[model samples]
Target: EPEVTQTPSHQVTQMGQEVILRCVPISNHLYFYWYRQILGQKVEFLVSFYNNEISEKSEIFDDQFSVERPDGSNFTLKIRSTKLEDSAMYFCASRDTGRGNTIYFGEGSWLTVV
Candidate 1:
């Protein structure tokens, strides 16, 4: 199975600051996504991107959050202004275009806001 990888496995940030989480999705996968798990909570979907455009987004992905496929290989999520509540484990995921394909998740980037 292909894999998704993320960088800065852990991060500490001041409240009201900016953060950028980087990811490298499987080369063959066409769809990429961002999800977050607040400690002890269920994984929540943030956004999905395909063909260089956003295909879907959840309410939690507000104006402060953004996703980008900067190049053929790198996918990124940016939090323009981090808040205390923003601290969570951010996961990058990807899947092939095939129907019913399994989505692969990265190890995740743990964000802690101070």
Candidate 2:
């Protein structure tokens, strides 16, 4: 069964520092997205990437944040300057071609800011 794998399940970073969260979705889905859950809050969409370009993005995805598919295999989300507000569980997901609009969140990277 294909699944999404995220590196560094947990990460602690100092405020104003840089952090890079990596993920690999082992599927041939056309839509890839990054969603974050801040503590007890609901999961919020950050950005969506398709065809190697950003198809959609939320307000939280500012200039400080960026995502990339370095080699078309691994997807990386970089925070140029980490902020306290950025501390949350960031989930990297993609649409399951086997399923409809249902996305599989097999892996998520947690970020902590001090």
- The model with the greatest lDDT is 1
Residue by residue across 38-104, what tens digits does model 2's lDDT show? 9999999999888899999999999999999988678889999999999999999888444457787
Candidate 2 wrongly placed segments (more than 4 Å): 96-99
Backbone clashes per model, in order?
A: 0, 0
TM-score for all models, in order of appearance:
0.97, 0.93
lDDT of each: 0.96, 0.89
Error of 1 at 53 (Å): 0.6
Model 1: which ten-residue window has the lowest total lDDT? Answer: 1-10
Local accuracy of candidate 1 as per-residue lDDT tens digits, 20-93: 99999999999999999999999999999999999999999999999998889999999999999999999999
Tell me model 2's lDDT, rounded to 2 decimals. 0.89
TM-score of 2: 0.93
